[model samples]
Target: MDAKQTNGGRRHFLKTGAAAGLALKVGVTAAEPRASTPALPMPEYEKLDALALASAIREGRLTALEALEAAIARAEARSQINAVALRHFDLARENAQRLSRMGRAERAAWAQTAPLAGVPFALKDLGVAMKGTVTTQGCAFFKDAVADHDSTLVQRYRAAGLNIFAKTTTPEFGQTATTESRLFGLTRNPWNLAYSAGGSSGGAAAAVAAGIVPAAHASDGGGSIRIPSSHCGLFGLKPSRGLVPMGPKMLEGWLGLSAQNVISRSVRDSALLLQLTQGPEAGSRTGPQPGALIDAITRPPRRLRIALMEQNPFGAPVHPECLDAVRAAARLCESLGHVVEMAAPKLAIGEMFGSMGIATAAGMLASVRMREKETGRTAREDEFEPLNWRSLQLARGYSAEQAFTARTVFDQAARTVDLFLGEYDLILSPVTAAPAPLLGAMSLDQPYESFVKVAMTASPFTAIFNMTGHPAMSVPLHWNGAGMPIGAQFAAPFGAEATLLALAAQLEQAAPWKDRRPVL
Candidate 1:
């Protein structure tokens, strides 16, 4: 956590800016409008995705400060969604001003090196860390926790020249499928505030959907990125395990059931993010070499054999609207020249779920113990929700043999899915059993059994790939009758993100969801 080690060479770039005066003028609150400056024309700001915004800044059509202010204005306007966990508006403004003040030649050079320079961005308040910033992880136990160093991924984000302005909410330890917690309150969906913004990356999804930022850093332990994207009508990709770094603190999350990526409004932004951050840091256990992910965005994938799965693997009845969404996506893929067939991989649902539960409980228990060690106090039961507290109890009872048995089960599931994918290019299914549910339906405070049932039904398909360590994405392709967005989940073989990105780009072009916006 040495300052020099954490900041590296970027300390001068971040700290030695002439923008301190401008930062003082902008103030610290993200929700405050800049009355001293001319009102920013927002339609243009809302229309451009992250890549387009970065391009404008590079071409001098827009100043980085203007982009940042526009994002701040939107964040203020959409305050009801409660997505902003902690704001660093002063720092963001200073960063923007510094970028705006760069010499033309210097700016041109920066553009070449930092493809996402001057773009405002947010990070989920879980997993990743930012120096001098508090990442509560949506839990009261760590409400005062401040990161001493930037996480490896945060360092990459800064190197890419993304302006890190704010952190988004998540369920405590990202333990639930909805973005509601005792600490951060409810993170409502932009499409409909009555519904939940699917979590634990829900706040990230809501921020992007609300146009606060075009894309936000999100991670998926078990469908966190994709569930929110599906609910919010955005594109989210969970890269294959080890394709995105999770290290410096820990090499893997939840025994490699997790991966870090972005929830983006555009396919290219996600592709570019993966291109920028996909690599091993020191002590990485797996080094999956980066592929041509960004280049794949421009190229249409060849005719693919897609497996269509309609039934929920967990035996929960798939909602009619969800069934309709996947069916429509299958038809669309068929029209796109991909052969579609009714197919699914056989899975031991009970074992897979049981193993996942064990892993999650073990992780939760370890995190609590680590926090206790750091704070010199044991965690109170009141600090955690009922389910997480129950997880701690469950973890205390689990033996090492049981943990290893869980890993065996996960390995078996991965092998089973790998065999299934040997005959197909991708598997297409519903991201969830239903569309975004009403807030409180998946609350962590609910009875453990009820929460488990809801969580299992809410996200059945995405976790399969999580267990298998295969690349998967939730592409926003359909809207239900109630006007909620339903995502069609597409998963590729392990380390086949190129295929997923190419197919996502093709779908984005075929059924453009760019212009779609929630009426806030």
Candidate 2:
């Protein structure tokens, strides 16, 4: 687990509970390949990108049941990764039949509507809800919090005609970066079974990377989305604070510290999902930008100056290899015809993210307390990692004056990054300080400082955007020679999802990763 291992050897260091899950004795059964991927498809599911699945359905190349069957088979074959949280063969089959009953015009409308229709989408354990299924946020208190109504995101997905085939796992309260929870144990990386998938959206990254669904829903308050996406070699975006709505229940997530988005294998898929799920809910305060997402994907980004970041104020070391990855990405952008230059802005990392973390952890603690009151049970001290307790304490310390000062500081930071973006179309940086880590590399069971250092080191690149409310994305641009994937982040001005998306589309076209996969 040495960070200085130059040869890309074993680098395990996952959050608490993950190190133990890597060798759970759950052997993965390899499914027959789809005639392309280097990794054999697991028995339960064979993933198809959102766009590809729609095309296949439209062309009659495969029925929804056929696709679901392949996916199920692939899931079974790759059981070691432990991606699927709930089996929905019966439900998926039923929905596919219902789709078959649609009239031609209805079917056509469905096809052209949301970018992910007719595709199998896995819902991450948090935020989104599916009726009759448990929506535990990795807590034993509400272990039976079966969802009675669909979350806004889930409703929108259904409206777009996506089949809700399964649910993925998450760490309790999603406080920890690793995805291990007592309920589902641990979710391992698809590339190397001995490593972590990453969290709080770790399960989605693991499932998507394993070709479980091509992509799954992900969220980030403090690098939850980007860290896992970077670790698993997928596309991850944390949108402008208000771009997507969280309504009928919440106006802002983690006091505006988090946003929900998808982590996928393609830029187009992320683009389309952003289009569908972006914008405010009915009772939302603000609406999405006045433009179409499909149109954004087609718009070519103008070549422009770029600001590259490569330093941390927290005394955390950015591994030499990770720095190399960022430099390589800078050169790639130059090769692709953009003026790239190094520029790390002076930022207050620990103070800002610490505040944000407190707010987020407080949200979970509030939930825990509520459950304690309602269910006559509480989370024992031993049940949560030390950082979880610290987050609760930090959030409790938020006085009225402190809250006001925090908001003012965030607004100021937003302006700073906005001014920074005015000169450059994109900001290039490493998504994490290191590459993919081995299981238990990070620990929910460790001391608060130990877990914080590990989690922050791997995810120093993403939270700055949450405070600023900018649109940012993680593109899977690098693969360590030994087969682990690494991601580099690119961010744009506030409300500039279009620019970020178009730039990502250009990269996708130039270096397609559709058929590239792991050998199970």
Candidate 3:
């Protein structure tokens, strides 16, 4: 149908029946008051971060079921964004009801152990798995692929007392920068519905930005975590490779390039989540020990040298607003008593991306083949998106020698970044070369070449740190004349997540972003 006609229908659906059937199917009675008696208004609930919400629940001011219902109400209200891929609202309510059954003394004792107990959380629909849930990964071929077991990360999330209610949208296999796929349509930005919510964690960012939840599970293989955080005005941290578990199903993702974490509104939520979930599982390779991230967030980092890079390494033209955001962040750092200089590590940008592409293609092909074996059906080209089909073809063409060469390049780049960090404590740059693009600008249905061009131009900085295995983050510090959020990127040495979190907390204190919520 025509664009205007389609949007008009969407608006009508959202206004009338978008969430009606889903609420009934999930057995959600959002209008009914809970027994705990006084529930906070939606606005007040949205104002509290996950930590504060947990504190309130612990103190008996609110019940876990009440918080879950509030989140459900918001999610239903913001259904027009199409951010959610799968809803487990009934299961989440069961979990929350279990918590509500506890006595006040029992609840307080449990809260002391499970710091974020009673907070609602969503998982990105790509990497990682939750038992009995279908992790479609935004691919038609995997649309019915139900996970029989939870990934190690999901176990940790449950242990931390987070209520997993839904799965967020993602691009097909998370191959693109924006979250749009045939399986789940466009996940739009909460700030502006026409604009894109950056991906492959777009839905996670959208949920948080829309006030459905204060934080959600997100993974970064390329720029997935930080890109959406930038677009949606949230704080996202991609911990160093091997710090967070990615195992039991797959040992590492994209040859150690992907790290799982959360896209959160507050620094402490991200820090505490990291502290709770990080560490190697049995039989997994471990990276450098991440020091106490909670402690790091509480205390400001010592003033140190920070490198500010404005130019895109790939020679792409960065938007003026993005450049302005980075400059403003640099000035903010200086005001906070840290030294900021204009410098970037020298590296073969072309080779780095080339290696990443090879790894990405191979990973996609492997996943497809594995699924094909399990299902006893070969995947057809028609079943895949254009870019993903092209990726499988490229993966078939590459030789073993080429894959080895890509690994070598990854190693060399990691060494180069490690040495660069010896001279500077952090690298500050734009999370994306531009602010979030409008929807359809980076759709995977387009020609593979054109899609790659747009994706690279939009997110030129984040994948490099992913390749180098360094911890990086996107801090929402600036907004353009149009009021779109622009995030400043920060990268530290491998295993220095503590340092990154500390500085992020400092920035949060110096220029707070907690009060800025999208008017959904």
Candidate 4:
């Protein structure tokens, strides 16, 4: 490559690019155009998940090293878009050693030969899962903070024999919407590095979107999982409040709105992983739900009822393309023999956003307090992103008298879904008000409260399910002009994962994301 006409061109960035080896695909060929800019080894890994990689390993088409090499290389090229906070290549290689020792049949049988068995995977560093790994929480506040134990989801992934490849980034205390944090800078979207991947699971979504890993663990409270998932074009779900357990930390998250799940390329993968990990971990909210979330996916959903609204009910305009996509899905449902009608129960976007703000801000303050208490440290208001600190401040503004009213609003909204759900199998809506935003689009410079407002445009519909404690899944049903993914959310009633999974699986079979990938 010739020297750039300008000193600050991509060429200059390449010299100081400073990509970590373990972050992206490793074996990128030099022939590629982006190769001059330190591209990841292979672009293909951007599209393939652990399950597919496992298949290649079994088929003798690709070795784990080949896969890992490719992933690390991609991280080098794409890390700027979605910063990968931690690398465990040594541990991952150790896990691969065990996988290499196992007979294919043994590994496959144990995986139930499940799709992801023996595949490489990653975890969001936010939750507790020491793995002797860094849990930066996107903060300078806890730069040295390391978890002492694995979160339940980590244990489940290990048991399933998924190689723990890397740790993705997140916002501090996951307080804000975009993925940027002081600890690791920012995680940009693959489609446009200038745009955000969406947060606090933004790093997780970015990694998956950039092809660093096929799928990664993420948690959603006020759209942490789904928002990034939507932005990154991966399938993301916030399992019903209790379907996936959150224990050893708190029995319920965000007053039971948050839950652990993943952003994946396929619905069955989400269902499959949830089946593997979800259940009543001791101290989980409510007892185990039913037979199994995985088995639940195989059965055909009964001829269902569906409510479809192509417009953002909150008065925000759904990008015309997104509106068309939702309408198309409704038409598809109609073709498949389900009842599809335009019915949107009255919902106030402002009230819902306000309640979500309190929940998010309160959670941030709790994390800050916990950090300070445990480490003998205190955070000045300036240490945090203003939006996050202000969220806490706003949360403090409410009185006990207001709490009841907020609860009433949350419960009433959620219950409306319950009642509406009784008449419909699932409610289909745009996952975000629009497509992924440019980086700094949701920047902290805006009034703290305004962040929530801007966030509502794409994320408004998601929090409703969290409020009601119903299971919600985001499916990658549409792609924009840029080939970036846009997801449509399907929400089911409380304890209705069985219902949702069954429906999701059918959709997966009908339209798969298995072969779709970006040019990493």
Candidate 5:
């Protein structure tokens, strides 16, 4: 693809930063829509959001089996995107068929009780687990690591009656922003296949964008969910750390820098999903008291102070288009009666990056060591990505004292941001420094320096909230001249998801994005 076509058929260069590199070529699925064999008309189910789908099932307008089949057909038709990591179509069909066989009263009871009942969904092939299914974190070594039991979050999803019919792609251990993995290959953007579907939740974001599912699970450690959402044109939110459960397998994800939720075309789906899944699990940390998140979105938000920061906190250059997106979002907030200021927190970004490096490297070492014990052997070089290998190597040189000191730095950074947030109810920023990079821009096999540069450049704005355990979201408020989606990020204080949701809903009303489907 030419430079123009690669960036959604538009011409521009924003000085590509590097990340873990892509291992494959991106296709033209986005530049030009796919030409597939004209299959029979699918049920009109694909056009509906998750809540609408569930309501249809409950109202006897569609059977669960019929809905699942429609989604399966869409998934099969769009297989060229390489978004699906593991398909559960047959299993889902069987389960839905069983549900269809129930009495009318029973079916209504099931649908009424489960908010997502009969809605087709997918889990990103990372942190969360499903019993008896492969929980491969996009690594060859863990290819055989079948989950023995459902993670707490998965249990909640099941209870909500979401028909999880597939697992979506992620980078190895969700280590980078782009989703291409040596184990699962590349997951390209549905908007423009020549570009990346930002990772490590790229597959889920891509699948949802391609209309295979209305929503899919996504986890953000370092902008995984928001990055993909920004690239794929969806609503993605990362809950405050310690708010969402990560139990049965883990008490915390990436030392509380990670949180899991779903990427959806509609804000209500995301807000409702959080309402369904948010709360503590066994061995989980306490979070803010719960409230009706779905109801919160229905109410108009109070006018509040919002800071608009378009520059990179580390002094890296942000792309002009990305800065434009943030500015546009800020203007929209102003029109909505919110106070918008051009401001950012004063913190030592360099020091924070250094400390994060230490903590991440140590975490990678522990993960590799745990896998080593599981396999009863050390990790073979070929089994791990080069970027992850480098992390392991860097971790080997760090001591426990260094790790503790790094933790203190994170604490300080969080405190600093907390104080800054005291004066402002929200921080508005660009979700990424630029539009989605071309496939192979941040290959996993690339040198360590090139990879980190691209990764950081691509996602400079979203990770600080993760570090601070604050609630953050990427709302699809703008699309660049390239036609590539560029999301504006909004972060609120710890456990302030309701505020974020309310604002998101108001924005969704002012500028609807659900109807903006990609060509794919």
Candidate 6:
């Protein structure tokens, strides 16, 4: 379809379907779609996940170039979503053509060995840096900053034969729960254009949900992956600290709270991506001992001991829909033979929050300084959104002793979680305190205190796992009355991604969400 035709249809779909579906939760009831809408065959690559796409390409029914072109077309068709930060279609075309030229035997061999071979993927603009690409961390200052070499993680992604064709949007410096930046405008939810897609991996989430690709790169340093996955109805796993590399430029992100992974429709795709892209690169300070995540998902998990947190620990008012989603997931687990009981690790809540705040502030400040050094100039007020600028100013004033004490508190909390996990194999909770909020609800232009309040309230559950360095995933098992997805989160103890993936895979089997496509 032409641009005008695509835009008109998108407007109609967003208004008629997304706006109307708000009255009923998505998974609970079906909305009446226009009867006049004709059924069209979905493109072969768009219908297949990464593994399936590779299988088709290897079997000679589809070529790598065909898959790339299909994805590029979908991305172009979904232009109304505003998910892309930058496009690399020309470079991707080059790569796809080269891959297509390989002998049939060579292609088949690579398909069997390289998990994501010939799959088109988008890199989250936050931290999955590509060589010579504009690796903007959702900041205007970094818009012109190009990467001199591939990040260690990016190298691994390329090595797996995934074709990188685009970069997705993120919040400035990835400091917020929402994905709106001064550089890139809003990244809207695919399910409902009026709602958020979650961030700083919002662009990646939107792209995948809109079928631009089966999966895309994402990072979570405070729920960048899971939050967006929750909002967009995709599977997102934040692997344990040290499981994914931070790389040649840095050992850790946000003091090891950040992790790299992908947001995907299928559990096996996420698990396989983790298996292939995980492990420490050279100069790594911390990472878990490598484990077989892909293998673990091949079978159902044993009856497991699970602890369920039904309410927000910080006393934030969780939306009733989020609460209901967790309860339903808990019931599903019970029916599946897993034991679920109300439990949470005893924590010094006030101190942990304070420490988290301090550490977070310090990390943001450090990143800003690093960028200033890179650019060799001070940041202008015009270059940052109000909240980021204020946070940087405040964090700059934090004393070393204060930062150290915050780290100590986080460490203590981690230790407490370790002890708590000794009694349970996994913990279940709501990924966010609420569903995807309206645009500008969590804007960085809000006052600093208000921004923090919104950010913390929207993302209470996921950041704790980041601090504790546990493996956590947001499973899209529920949708609210407004048809917005509210994910149920599951976190396993440190270095136990295998357990989590197996359980996620089993859950996927029990309630298959693969066919649940968005209206827009």
The Cα local distance difference test for each model comes to 0.85, 0.72, 0.86, 0.70, 0.82, 0.82
lDDT tens digits, residue span 146-181, model 6: 888898888888888899999998888787877888
Best by lDDT, which number? 3
**lDDT of candidate 3 over 398-429, digit per residue (tens):** 98998889888988999999999999999999
- Which stretch of 10 consecutive residues in model 6 shows the poorest summed lDDT? 19-28
The predicted structure with the larger TM-score, 1 or 4, is 1
Across 1-520, the per-residue lDDT of candidate 5 in tens digits comes to: 3333543311111122111011011111223343443472343444578887776566555567877887888888888888999987877888788876765578778767686777788998888889878878898888888888899999999999998889998988888888898898888898888899998899999999988888999999879999999999899999988777888766876666778999998888898899999988877656766658999888789998999887898788999988888898999999999999989998787777777777767776777788889889988888989888878888899988988777787778789889999999999999988789999888787987777778878667888887778889999988888788899999998889999999998888887776577875
Error of 3 at 142 (Å): 0.9
CA error at residue 133 for candidate 2, angstroms: 2.3
The TM-scores, one per candidate, come to 0.91, 0.87, 0.91, 0.84, 0.91, 0.91
Candidate 1's displacement at residue 285, Å, is 2.9
* Error at 8, model 4, angstroms: 46
Alpha-carbon lDDT of model 2: 0.72
Off by over 4 Å in 5: 1-43
- Least accurate 10 contiguous residues by lDDT in model 2: 6-15
lDDT per residue (tens digit) for residues 157-225 in model 1:
999999999999899999888999998899999888999999989999999998899899999988999
Query: Which is the better candidate, 4 or 5, if ranked by lDDT?
Result: 5
The 10 consecutive residues of candidate 4 with the worst lDDT sum are 17-26
Ranked by lDDT from best down, the candidates are 3, 1, 6, 5, 2, 4
The sequence of per-residue lDDT tens digits that candidate 4 reaches over residues 1-520 is: 1223422332332233221222223133222123233345544444455655666555434445556767677666565675588888788887676666665566556655345555777788776565577777666676777777777767777877677778888877776668877667778887677788888798888887666777788988877888887777777888877777676676676666678888876665677777778778876547447447777776778888888866675766778767755666676667667787777666766787677666666666677778899799787776777766666677767676666666677778877777777777788887778777776667664685666567667567777787777788777666777767777787877777787778766666666554455555
Winner of 1 and 6 under lDDT? 1
Q: The CA-based lDDT of model 1 is what? A: 0.85
Indicate whether candidate 2 or candidate 4 has the larger TM-score. Answer: 2
By TM-score, how accurate is candidate 6? 0.91
- Candidate 6's C-alpha runs over 4 A off are 1-42
lDDT of 3: 0.86
